[model samples]
Target: MNMEFTPDQLQRYHRQMILRELGAAGQQKISDAKVFIAGAGGLGSPAGYYLAAAGIGTLAIADNDLVELSNLQRQIAHNTERIGMLKSDSAQSTFKALNPEVNIISITQRIIAENVAELIRDFDIVVDCTDNFAVRYLLNDACVLMNKPLVSGAVAGFKGHLTTIIPGQGHCFRCIFEEMPPDAEEPSCRQAGVLGAFAGVIGAMQAMEVLKLVTGAGEPLKNTLLIYDGLKSEFRRVNAPRNKDCPVCGDDPYITIPGC
Candidate 1:
């Protein structure tokens, strides 16, 4: 084992460090990684919590929305007292409390195309916990252009799905969903009514994927879409192969711009 980890850190992560796949070396990789999470709502909550507890070196959470009373249903990072606070700020506070060793950066600004590249430029990995399709596409394109790995998760009603996208190695988000669905076609969580615990399930999985990516512990979900059906209590993995014709990560591409 390396002498870099403090006695407290080694004890705190003793259980994980004992795992055959992730020993002290893997833990060191995790401690040196910088992760960017693009939301602080349901999906972001558990994802951030687990990553913080796992001792991610630096975590940056970005969200422009304010916590509403309804958000408490699944947004575990924020409590009733923080109902009106910015989601990013609330998540930072919660993550900091979970692991004071983690460097948490709270960004309360919207992640528009104009600033997406700059926001993620310094990070080693990006986690897509955003709710909408527009920001998803924005993140997908930006990650592809920047050659960053992205752990994407989404939940709606009793269903949730997750996938890991590595720039050149696998399919990008556009390969699976060609274009953003019309707003009317896709109902927001408000209309569909998400199950709180279901979001936690997928969010925790996202964190696991990040850990795998960081430490090279095991195979990640790259080019695979993991689906969860809470009502039926089933989990499915679907093959999501790369599209050679994909605009973002294809041979003859079109979306060469980082955040367009």
Candidate 2:
């Protein structure tokens, strides 16, 4: 891979390039990476921002929802002026303004079983920024089937959890949460009330994980779940070993195809 950098590129990524762990080579890797983010909401906002700012070559954001007044508190990528705009479009505008060098692709469609595979097929990494269990599970299954690395994060109330799934290497999201809970049992951010800044914390960490995976800078949170408690201001790591019987990424995997 070419490690050559134009003067402007070097100047833009000088601080990151200075790190012994991630020199010009790492920057080149990062610049060549294509990351697909599932949602353009709270988590996607910060994750997308940092990835674009870091000079990621291509960023694809998928979201069919429209921005609303209520989203501005946590969905930093969207503003009051962008109300009613497609979330993906709003995110594209924000990320482009932050770093015009980034190639941003906005997919204004809800990710579904029929299209999830095609949506993420070309990306090097997948970031789960979706809010609901259905979409989360869909993304997990798709990534596992495609043998792609996935960085998953979730936030509710004052707490947030994050994990990275590298297909055959470690546990996937399903290993930790075998199946999605019933709708009534699963509380939405609207019902539980999430702290805006708390979402930023987890989203930023997700972005960090992606950078690490791209540049090989530090350990990606393989098989480990990182939890943050905003009220206590503490972080904890839990072991998440792969489930040999996991339906999607197990010895006798049930989900052989992307949408199955």
Residue 132 in candidate 1 has what lDDT?
Answer: 79
Name the best candidate (by lDDT). Answer: 2
Off by over 4 Å in 2: 184-187, 258-260
lDDT of each prediction vs. the true structure? 0.91, 0.92
lDDT of 1 by residue, 17-53 (tens): 9999999899999999999999999999999999999
Regions of model 1 farther than 4 Å from truth: 1-3, 184-187, 258-260
